[model samples]
Target: MANTRPLVAQWSRLGNSSIAACKADIPRPALVSYQTVRHASGKPASKDKDKKKRKTRNTFRQYDLKHAMQFSLIDAMHYIRAFEVGQNPASAKYEMHIRLSTLKNGPVIRNRLRLPHPVKTDFRICVIAPPDSKAAADARAAGAALVGEDDIFEQVKNGVVDFERCICHTDSLQKLNKAGLGRFLGPKGLMPSAKTGTVVKDVGNAVKNMVGGSEYRERMGVIRMAVGQLGFTPDEMQRNITSFMDTLKKDIAQLSDRITKDIHEVVLSSTHGPGLTLNGEFKSANSIPPKELAGPL
Candidate 1:
């Protein structure tokens, strides 16, 4: 009772000084609105939204699972053969070209496929090894058109590389390298390398494989390989094409995690006919329109 009235008056007098000292020592932060703080920091409140928009623009278009096409192996063959059969001279042969989309760091894929129905061609193979070596004898026995080391080298040096495929033994590699034939063979894709299975220990097996194998190489993101000739039965052609596509799919599956898209489109055509794009989904052989052919056969 004695101090109550005076207590407020007494505290006010004491501290003007104490309160000012306390405030100075604490160093109070300035009161700023959220908008003012953001402006001062030079960062927009919508920065996250802006980033999201940019990310969406750069990403690949994601197709819905329902919209994905399911192509029929048999139906694709039917349409492809129909187009070829209608060709003027019936195209010397039918070729299958597959185009792919890949990421920057994707694997460089090349495969040698032996189709169920081989495409018959006039292409010949030559073997370079010691004339008396077993490899040379094996090569000769295996159907190599030409087999000799120095003789083959001479022919190659003199601009007489008539063969489409060249196989060499490990022993002759040094000689070939010394001859500086790389400048000649490299551009033609006839140079023998381990990767292409053109350099081998068993010349017989290599030559045999080369004779039957169809090389599918990825160049500029496209794979071009001969599926079968127009002379083949439709059933044979279908099996060949299906086998190739199945193998391709399996190989690509190994790299699926890093791939952007496995295949963009698969267009089938003969040597002379217009291409028919197989829309990832299969259609019945009877339902496919013959007029889907791009141009007059």
Candidate 2:
């Protein structure tokens, strides 16, 4: 539970450096496990902050596990409930927060969070279809039409769906609040509030809704109930999955065919939750964590 002589020397140099390049390039006080760093067993005994009585006398900083070396960010953010004698100063408490003592306006220096690209859907539904043929476009744009993602865009681009078509039959859109929208919006990286602002009478309105930046929020719940129902058959589950994959593939294809080359891992799960675990898909191991990428906040 101590900054070794070498580490202290290294940190001191970093702390006092005059050159902005190396100093800025370096991030100090990384979350390191005293257990792993300890050459002996005399490190401070581990304590659970949740179980102990805490006062404002301690400091804590949250960190992302992937970027913070060994410990996860949530775990790294924990503070010491009580201090023990002979604890190492650096190891005495949880201090993962980025402390910018000097910079008034500069790059943030801490374990940052990233998100993956959204899972899009293929234009399967008919209502949202574009005016590939005047007949096809006229059929739906004139009246009741079934729509999908692409079709929605097509109609909007060609002037099909509009304010009239967007009129809602149910009051679903109004129910979307900060809490409900955050659930799927955050993880899917989708900028929409699943319930509210989902319906539109016209294609122009749908596109405009997205352009206007509808209700998008970050997810706070890492743990959840289920992405889908538990009892779905594999084929049924696959239909939903392919719908998602089709969208993902289309977005990825927009970049390059060799996109798979950058893949770190590919996991196909029916529903990631308790009791029913359905996993089957051909994927690359190189697939990176979604949060590592920039996403709609």
Which pairs of residues have clashing backbones in candidate 1?
A: 70-281, 70-282, 71-280, 71-281, 71-282, 72-282
Give stretches of model 2 more than 4 Å off.
1-227, 255-263, 266-297
- How do the residues 36-144 of candidate 2 rate in per-residue lDDT, one tens digit apiece? 4563666443346444756543222223333322322111111111122234322222111111122223221111111121122121122333345343344344443
Query: Against the true structure, candidate 1 has what lDDT?
Result: 0.70
- Give the least accurate 10-residue stretch of model 2, judged by summed lDDT: 109-118
RMSD of 1: 14.5
How do all models score by TM-score? 0.66, 0.22
Compared to the true structure, candidate 1 yields what TM-score? 0.66
For each candidate, C-alpha RMSD in Å?
14.5, 22.5
Worst 10 residues of 1 by lDDT: 26-35
- In model 2, state the lDDT of residue 120: 22
Among these predicted structures, which one has the highest lDDT? Answer: 1
